[model samples]
Target: MTAAPVEGELAMVGEVAEQLRDVRRHVDFFDNDVHQARDLAREADSRSLATETTVAGFARWLERLEQSNEALRRETATLRGHHPPDPQRPPRHRCSRYAPPIHLSALGEEAGDTA
Candidate 1:
C-alpha cells in the first residue's frame, strides 16, 4: 500500500499555501478602494452623463482590481485542492514546530515530497 504524506510535509505545504495566499490576497488588499471606485464611477455617470474621463479611468482600475481578486481566489482554490488539510494531523496549518517523523523505508520514498 502507498504511504500517506507525513504530517511535517503537509505542514510545510500548508505553511506555503498560507503564505502564498496572503501574498495573493494583498494583490487586491484595497477592497475598500475597489468598492469606492465603483461607486464613484456610477455616480459620475449621473453627474457627468458619461462625459468625465476620471470616471472611466476609475472604472477601468476597479475592473482590473476585481479581475485580479478573482484570479487570486482561483489560485487559492487550486492550491487547496492539491494540499487538502487533515485536521486530525498535528502541526496544524502554520504550526511547524512538530518534528517530521523518520521515513527511510520504501514507503517513505513513495511518499515523495509529501514527506
Candidate 2:
C-alpha cells in the first residue's frame, strides 16, 4: 500500500511539471505577440503623422494658389477697365488665322447666285 501511494505521487508530479512547461511556452508566445502588436502600432503612428504633414503642406500650397488667382483676377479686371474692348467689333476667333477672310462674293457662289 505504501509503495502504491509513492508511485501515484511521483506520476502526479511529472504531469504537473509537463503542464508547467506548456504554460511557460504559452506565456512566451503571448509576449512575442504583444511585442509585434506594439511595433505595428508605432509604425502606424509614424505613417499617420507623415500623412498629416503632407496634407498640411498641400493645404498651404492651395491657399497660396488661391491668393495668386484672386490677385490675377483683380489685375485683369483693372486692365479691362483701363482699355475696354470695342463693342462695335466682333470678338476674334482662333480659326481666323487658319483661313482667308470671307467675302460677300464667296457667299453668293455658295448660294448659286452672284449678288
* lDDT for each candidate structure: 0.76, 0.87
Q: Where does candidate 1 clash, by residue pair?
A: none
Which lDDT tens digits does candidate 1 get at residues 1-115?
1335577788899999999999878866778678889999999777786566678889999999999997887788688774434458764455463567765675766677765
Weakest 10 consecutive residues of candidate 2 by summed lDDT: 106-115
lDDT computed for candidate 2:
0.87
- Candidate 1: lDDT over CA atoms? 0.76
lDDT of model 2 at residue 87? 75
**Candidate 2 displacement at residue 61 in angstroms:** 0.9
* 66-93 per-residue lDDT for model 2 (tens digits): 9999788778968867443467988668
Off by over 4 Å in 2: 1-6, 82-115
Off by over 4 Å in 1: 1-5, 27-32, 50-115
Clash number by candidate, in order: 0, 0
